[model samples]
Target: MDAHTVTRIGSHDKDLQELFCDYVPQVFRRADFRRWRAWGQWSDDYHAYALMEAGRVVANTSVMRMRLVLEGREVTGYQLGAVGCLPSHRGRGLARVAMNAALDACGDAPVLLFANPTVRQFYPRFGFQPQRQTLFTTTYDSVPEGPPALTLNLDDEEVRAGLVALSSEGLPSTERFGARGYATVASWPVANGFARPLRQLGSEAWVFAGVEGETLYLDDVFAREPFDLRAWIPRLIDRPIRAIRFGFTPERYWPGAVEAGEDTEADLFVRNLQLSPEAHRFPIMAHT
Candidate 1:
């Protein structure tokens, strides 16, 4: 630790922010941090704590300010992501140092993160308890008769502007444990092509979804007002999806016997807060 310098750079810090962005892709091959930063939606609330060896980043942890809806109440929290160290820097406790700095900055606020399966044992050392998340799933019979939802390309300035406007409304897709700021964290996935934005013709609602095989993963929805999602699901999808999985709780909008399953992608860990798996699941797009 003595040979390295610990620095925290916010989104507003251009030079240091660029340094962090340049270092991230080396660790996360799919991360387009440079493009996300240039998209102009990078919130100052997102901060990166990095261990710099001379002028290059050796290890890093990012803390993103999140507005979470917990059990129907809106609250503030911190989400940690982009947490890793270069291979040369491993086994030196640099990652631990960066995590400590990030947690310290959060103070008493609830902190959460989605960690890779390989590092499942590391977070508990810092009081982060492994938590379960509910994945709501349901089966559909057939594709309804209507125009398929249009996939809004993020590259278009008009589509980007529309998403920003919808997100500024600041509505949580679900009242039971979801995210408030839609475009804040969601833009990363859209910009990186990890997820696509879709909308039905003559509708104001927009959906962020991912597809695999015959299943559609409905990550999040941005609409000015609440509507019956169960009915809208058919119109929202283009191809015939045999199953639909929701990232957020669906009890409010879609009130049917949707199977509640466990998340298999990444493990969720949190500190200073109790997030119940059966009660609510964090919005998928809100993940950093």
Candidate 2:
């Protein structure tokens, strides 16, 4: 016989908050929780449902509110984050309990998550189908005129808003608009000075990236002007940059050296179709 209680804890629950904060570094094992704690930013809108056993959190899953747009219509959904169970708590189905509780709390909104390839098969049983993203690659030499560049400093609110402003430049094509009201922004910072600022051509280029190896992978891009991304490739590098990659591609197509392919490098699994899968992409900047 097992006895445990399930509770949804937000920032207000001080004691459980401390316990969960301690538990994350243990289960995740790879991320720097210290940086996350140092940020000192907590979202009351994000909730973690945990299985409490003997006064300790054993299994947990976080649920986040998402205000999405599908074909220009407003839609609501939720994103699942940091789902795991303590090593000793495995095989106990505590994760399942926490997940179900999250879904119920979310009512009927769709639930989405980015899952690793190894555990990709686990979400389907819970009704999480794979969502596809379009990828673009190109190697170009033409240096075309483009919107001036602007450095995206996470420390600066204006810069962050400029990044968010790109979502509304013309029409809502991706999921950044859905994340407008949510403070769940999380991303790998621009490092090594491969690049400093996210370039913009009058709100055209919504991007953040640093080069690695010889390839300049734009952490993400959403430039709808003229549509051909190859024209903007040359502007991305100050010294020398080789091939370019898109973290997320727009539904519209662009000509030139750019090549397109449907890929699964980053997998999004959704339990509900609250947001249509057609030409859908959650921007890299909106990661939680």
Query: Cα lDDT of all candidates, in order?
Result: 0.78, 0.61
Q: Give the Cα error of residue 75 in candidate 1, in Å.
A: 0.8
Candidate 2 wrong stretches, greater than 4 Å: 1-3, 32-34, 37-40, 142-150, 156-183, 187-206, 221-235, 252-262, 274-280
Q: List, residue by residue over 1-288, the lDDT tens digit for candidate 2.
A: 143567888866778777787788678765433344334444566788988877787888888776665555666788887788999879877888888888888887877787778888777878788877656667744332445355556455565455545544533334322344433344323321223356664456555654655666665554444455455565665546656665544444323325366656667787766545444456555555
TM-score of 1: 0.91
Writing each residue's lDDT as its tens digit, candidate 1 over 20-86 gives 8778888888886877777776678788999988687889989998877787787899999999998
Q: Write down the RMSD of candidate 2 (Cα, Å).
A: 4.6
Clashes of 1: 0
What's the TM-score of each model vs. the native?
Answer: 0.91, 0.75
Off by over 4 Å in 1: 1-4, 200-203, 277-279
TM-score of 2: 0.75
